[model samples]
Target: MIHIRKSGRDDASGLAAIWRDSVLATHDFLSRDDFIEIEKLVCEQYLPKAEIWIAVEDGRPVGFMGMTESHIDSLFIAPDQHGKGIGRQMIAHARALAGILTVDVNEQNVQAVRFYRHMGFVETGRSPTDDQGRPYPLVHMRLGEQRPTDD
Candidate 1:
């Protein structure tokens, strides 16, 4: 059975690998150089943050989610694990911890946008560019109407 648990310092490498592979599979919109830069930040800075969780299946890590307060900063599952409901389980875990979950998904990623929608997240707004001012747009979404953020 798959389980969600707090990530440890030792999980950084595994999580980075999952993030890299998952992004390469689903985020084709990203430029090659952009993907490289993002991976560096993820390995060197982001995964060190404590509010992260991992999905373990049969003694191996397959996915992870990074959060801050109620916002899901990132969520990625190994490409091979895509259809196994791991992402749904991860989001449920986040909701349990934060009450409600918010996420910013790449607007160009139709699958991710649809996935979040089916998971009960609704779009609140859109940004012309990502947080770093990259040309990639973000679709901001939140779960239902609980504690909504004014868009």
Candidate 2:
């Protein structure tokens, strides 16, 4: 059986590997250079403020996810484990911890957009251009509308 658990310091390398693999696997939209830059960005900006989780099967990590108070920052599952529902479990685990979850998915990433839609996350709106002049649409979503958890 697969289990979702909080990621510890030791899991950083595994998460990094999974992130790298995911970027490479999705090269149709994300280039190799983009992957390198984003990996560095994720290490610097996204890691510290967010909480990480791992999906384990018989003590081996197969997937990973990260979250901040304002967003479901990152979710990456090993390519081989994609259809096994690890991603869904990871999202549910994050939801349990933080009821209101959000994410900014690339508009061109059709698979991600469909996945988020299946998960019940609606698109709030687009984001402003950064210093680089790239305007990426931001999809904001909340898990529970009635009562958000304090934890």
Each model's lDDT: 0.90, 0.72
Candidate 1: tens digits of C-alpha lDDT, residues 55-89:
99998999999899899999999999998999999
Q: Write model 2 residue lDDT over 1-151, tens digit each, in one string.
A: 8988887777777777777777566535655666677789776666544687789998988987877774777788887887788888887887788887888776665677778788777888665532234544444555555445599
Best by TM-score: 1
Off by over 4 Å in 2: 128-136, 146-151
RMSD of each: 4.4, 4.7
Query: TM-score for each prediction?
Result: 0.93, 0.80
Over 4 Å off, model 1: 145-151
**Cα misplacement distance, residue 2 of candidate 1 (Å):** 0.7
lDDT of 2: 0.72
N/CA/C clash count, model 1: 0
